[model samples]
Target: MEYVLVLYIEQALKKGVVQTMEMGLAEMGRVLRQRVLLIVLVTLLAVGLAGAGSFLVLEPEYEATTTLLVQSKQTEKGIAYNDLLTDQKLVTTYGEIFQSRMIAEAVIERLGLDLTEQELLENVRVRSSSESLLTAVTVTDHDPKQAVTIANAMAAVFMENLGRIMQVDNVSILDTAKLTSDVLEPVRPKPYLNMAVALVLGAMAGAGLALLLAFLNNTVQTEAEAEQLLQLPALGAIPFFEQKGSSGYRVVVRQDPRSAVAEAFRTLRTNIQYDEAGKHVKVLIVTSTLAGEGKSMVLANLAVTMAQAGKRVLLIDGDLRKPTLHHVFHLGGQIGLTEVLCEGVAPEEVILPSAAGPDVIPAGAIPANPSELLGSPKLRGLLSDLRIRYDLVLIDSPPLLPVTDGQVLSTLCDGVLFVVRSGEVARDQLQQAKGLLERVGAQVIGAVLNGKQRKRSEPAYSYYAAPEGDPHD
Candidate 1:
């Protein structure tokens, strides 16, 4: 039983390793796809540099080779098989001798070349096959004729020294190095091979850089990440969209009621309406970790969607410092929340009707003290009064981390709906916002992931035409 348990544990560990590898590969593929342009640019730059170096920067080198045949002197027995094998073995030894300093110095001296023995040896190469009785000596230089001269000179000098060093004169020249008018091609600086290698290396470097950048990025990019970091349920994912030739705030649910963005708002509305804990939530505050995250736009559209669903909804621009609900609804912002709270103005007089099917209350005039006014007893009483007048009251508050207005408003609201823009707010900022709200004893119902990047391959939400009554009819 113990052995069986150990085997089970071993299988589990193997499965875990396989899963880890698969996840790593998936993350790498995602990074590669997102940074393909960077990789391509890097590869092209490397190829260009390689081409420039190969053609213009580096000097060309030419190679010339000379071959020598080693054999036993003819005797009564033409040549024994053993002697042939001995000669073949000697060919390898002769190859090393051909590249020795003595041969290099003699070749340099005979050619009147100004180079050290080591320098000349560096440019020389020798090769011999164990199965054959032939050795080849090759020399490389900048000039084709000079390479041919050095190679032939090295072979002759080696042949002259072979008799005295080994006391055998059986070596003969097989092929002398020669340069024809058409065969003066340089063997160095292979442009195609260099460029190919540079491209591969550059791609590898770019991919590594891309992975590092992805690792360092701390923004909440996906709905799942936002949920995990903020510890909130994702109510809806709003897809990003652009309207050509339009500006300012847009009420997608009111204007283009059939768009994916509009449907997303409807989904959010349904989730909030049927939420087990949020069903009775009357006053909900919508805010984010920072400004410019589209929280105001989300709240505006959400109010319109609720009104369209046969519910009485009141949209309040609680962000007095930077109110946008009036601009969104095209309503006059002369007298609204500020006037009602500070000026003792009647709420009925300042409450304006919007074409978007909701009662709108703009931010009115900018106040020197928004935090003080939001936390006043008058604001709390106004919200309590509005709670009885409307089925749902949605407030647009400022970002939590930037000011205490959202936090103060959250204390009065029944629930808070956090709006997070993808790739805009970092995970730590979300955590901070969550902590601030929790400290204020606020009820965070859920979160809306706004501006979510949608892939083209993912099927869009659209109504397909139903089949007409059977063709048999």
Candidate 2:
């Protein structure tokens, strides 16, 4: 029984190992596909560097070679089999003699070259053929002519000294060393070959590095990740819009109602209107984990969309420290939220109506103590009054993690719409924002994934502003 149990455990362990390896391979493939452009760019850059090094950075070397024939001194015309074997054995011995210090010194002296015996020998190489009585000697140097001179000198010196050293006059020169001066092709630095090798190596390195970075990046980039990490339903994914020319912060519903950006906001509005707490979400606070995440733009668009849907929406710029709703609605920002809360101004007097369908209450003044003001009971009474008057009240608050304003104001609203920028806010920062909302007993109904870039393969509706003619006609 114990043996069977151990066997089962071992089998289970093997299955687990296989499953882990398969999962890791699948993740690697995903990273490779996602970062293909990065890998290609890195590979091209590396190939360029390699080409530069091979052509301009490294020194070129030239090689010259000479061949020597080893034979027997026996004068008999009829050669014995034993004589052939002896010649074959002498071929290897003669090869070693070609690279000997004595030959190197003699060659340097004969050529009048200023080099040590060891240094001269370092450039010389000797090898014998397996099926012949021939030995080849090669010399390499930076100068082509010098390489040829060294090869010829080494061969001559070896021939002169071989008879005295080996007690046999059998070696003879078969071929002389030759030199070629082709500036187009260098022997040592092959630029194309080096670049090709570097291309492959750099691609592998770039892929590995991209995979490592993807693995280490703990950020919410997709809807599933936001839902999984924060345990909140992703209300919508707001596609990224290029803010250029006259298009500032896109109020898509009014500018291009049929475009994808406008369609996305409409989808977001529909999702917000039909969620579990949709009917009860009368006064909702919209804020993100960090600043510059387009949370304010999201709130403005949501409010515009709701009002366009026949709901009376009151848009309040709750971010007194750095307010943007006033600029967004072209209202006076110097006396909006601060005047109503601190100076006892009426809500109806400060509300600015817009053609976008939403009435705005901009953050009028930049108060020194924003957190204290938002936390005051007067602010709560104002929100209550607005909620009673308007069908929907969307408050654009400061970033949750940066200041205590969002967290403090979250308790006064019906629910909090946590906005996270895709590939912007770290997972830890998002988690901290969630934790703060939880600690304050704030109701977080759902989240919005902002600035998601649409894939190139996906259909775009950028030019579809509206229909050409009225259908009623």
Candidate 3:
């Protein structure tokens, strides 16, 4: 039993290792797939740079080769196997002697070449074929004529010295050193091969860098990230929309009702209506961690969408410090929220109708103390009164981190819809924003991930398609 249990444990360990390896491979594939464009662009640039450097930076070297046949001197008896074996052995020895300092010095003196023995030997190479008694000596130099001259002189000097040094005089020249007209093109520094290697290296470097950046980036980028970081459900993910020609203050849902941007708001409307605490969430305040997060834009568009669905929606600009509803709605911001709060103006007087959709009440004027005004008792009473008249009251408040206006308004509202700009708010900042709302006893119903751009490779959603009736896969 003990032996069987140990065997089982070994199997389990092997299975676990395999699973871990599979997981690692999957992760690598994901990283490479997502950053393929960056890798390709970097690889192309590297290949161009390497090819250009090979041509412009590296020194050119020309080569000249001399082949020789090694044999025994003519004998009365026919050449024997032993003689062939001995000649083959001497071929290797002669190869070494071809590059020796003695032969290099002789060749330099005989050819009047201006080079030291070491430098001359460094430029020369000799190789002996294993299957034959053939030795080839090659010389490389910047000048093609000099390389040929050195190679031929080295071979001649080796033949002359062989008889004196080893008493063997059977060396025969098979081919003299020669070069073609195209000797200017060097054999080393192959540009095409260098570029190919550079491309692969650059691709690897780019992919590694992309993976590192993705791992280090701690910003909220997707709906999943927003929900995971903030501990709240993702209410909606709004796609980024580019403003085209003839740009004016108009809600995208009203101007281009068939656009994806308009569909996103409508989806947001359905989500809000079906949320766990949504039935009682009539007064919803829209705010984000910081300014320029598109919370105000989302609020305005959502208000327009809800109104188009025949709901009585009241769009109020609660950001008194820096009001933009007037600009968005193309209405006068002279008399609105401020007039109603300080002067006790009638709600109907400040609440004006928009040509596109919804009734908008712009922040009248910039207040010196926005937090104080929002935290007043009358503001809460005003919201309560508006809730009774309108089916839904959507307030576009200031960002939570910059001011206390949104937090104070959160206390009065039924629910808060936190908006996060994808890739804009860091994880730590989003966490802090959520903590602040929770500390104030605010009911954060859900979060909206705004300005998310869809990748080009993703398939398009059929907005006009009919729903399928099938329930099973």
Candidate 4:
């Protein structure tokens, strides 16, 4: 039981991370845009740190350099100095005297420093150039005056220590170390260079994080995702329409009647006609996983498209809760479906003619029991009567997952069409909606993607949603 409980907790945490990553990838472009201000602020902060940290943390320490001269005595011919070739042999001895603790201790004592011989040695450096007997000693300290004093003291002590240790007077300081009266500048923390490094590092980090998120994410954001998830052939893609006017609403077959939008609907119409199993599509229902998915608008435009093709299309405003079909056609909602059911009006009579719309039944009043009304026997009978009167019946339903209205109506319809807004409906939510329809045995033919982005690289599928605003789907 404990092992099972631990497994359950681990699964839960994994699910949370997966969900977050999926959401990020699904909205990758929008997420990048949203973080623009944050990226700018981070760059500014890096610059400020580069500038302020450079000035305070750096301390100046001056260095004093002095060279020692040693010449080898050698001659090709007979000479007194030729017999005494001792300068070359004295090089190592001279180098050791400059580095010895005794010489360093004497220098510190003469210069009046309270530091130990080891501490004094830390400030002194002795070395020779390549193939040369010239020894160089350098002393560094916080003040220029003190650095010069230590350098001269160490040089004087090195000569004294060399005569005693090597038993020869072969070493001497060529020049005395002195103070220049000017303070040496500190060298540390280059602000410009630091800022540049930070910029490069920060950009690389951001890019790595973005790629990691993109790879791990699995939410449905593309039209390709919908096609792959449902395993259905894509029918057609409708461009997002902003409003109901000339520029808005892509059902150009209904509005413009001669443009590309009209062309797309005709293509969709052709696909529907070619479906052998779904060829007898009469009473069709359109719905989505959530509201604001443009189900009503798509329904209106599809009906309009069929009507233009010389088919008697009947558009029904089946969303009894929040009826928008009535407003779109500017029709009189004085009496509609509720009145037809209660007042016993003929199904044909409730079907009103529109000025531009083919035929529509406006939702007269807000019904209390929407699911019940849709599930009633009258709805099927009404559909049968309308099927004979009109060539096609288009039923606009509420969101599938939000209510059971679409589910109840689906049983009576010939087939159902699900509308999914790209980037708006989460992958899991759509999966849930699909599961609900399957449980109820609804025949979902294919999905209609409503709003699509303008990006060319984006795959052609149902719809595309961005962070800016609603792409109709």
**Top-lDDT candidate index:** 1
Q: Model 1, range 1-473, lDDT digits (tens) per residue?
A: 99998898677544332122234786788767878888888889999999999999999898888889998987996999989998998998998888788888888889999999999999888889999888888888899989899988988898899889999888999999965335666788889899999999989988887776776566787778788877878999998865222766678887778778888889999999888768989999999999978898889889999999999999999999888888888888899899998899999988899988999888898999999999999999999899999999999999999999999999999999999998898776888899999998999999999999876446866542223464542
* lDDT by candidate, in order shown: 0.86, 0.83, 0.84, 0.72
Which residue pairs clash within candidate 4?
A: 449-462, 451-473
Q: Residue-wise lDDT of candidate 3 within 110-185, one digit each (tens)? A: 8887889999999988889757989988888888888898888988899899989999888999999875335467
Q: What is the TM-score of each candidate against the true structure?
A: 0.80, 0.83, 0.79, 0.64
Query: What lDDT tens digits, residue by residue, belong to model 2 across residues 1-473?
Result: 99998898677544332122233776677668778899999999999999999989999988888888887766667777788898999888888887778888888888888999998888877889757999988888888888988898888888788778878887888989875444434478888999999999999989987876775566677887799878989999888875333745557667767878778889999998989877688999999999988898889888888988999999989998888987776666667889988899888788989878899988887888999999999998888788789999999999988899999999899999988899898877888899999999999989999988776556766445546774532
Runs of candidate 2 exceeding 4 Å displacement: 1-37, 58-60, 75-93, 129-132, 179-186, 216-218, 242-250, 462-473
* Per-residue C-alpha lDDT of model 4 across residues 300-409, encoded as one tens digit per residue: 77777777778898888889999887777777777898777666777666678876657999877877888888888887888888889888888889898789898898
**Residue 323 lDDT (model 1):** 89
Per-residue error (Å), model 4, residue 233: 2.8
TM-score between candidate 4 and the true structure: 0.64
| Ordering by TM-score | 2, 1, 3, 4
- Point out where model 4 deviates above 4 Å: 1-188, 212-219, 244-263, 458-473
Candidate number that wins on TM-score, 1 or 2: 2
Q: After superposition, how far is residue 365 of candidate 2 from its true place, in Å?
A: 2.6
Number of clashing pairs per prediction, in order: 0, 4, 0, 2
92 in model 1: Cα distance from truth in Å?
Answer: 5.5
Cand. 4 Cα-lDDT: 0.72
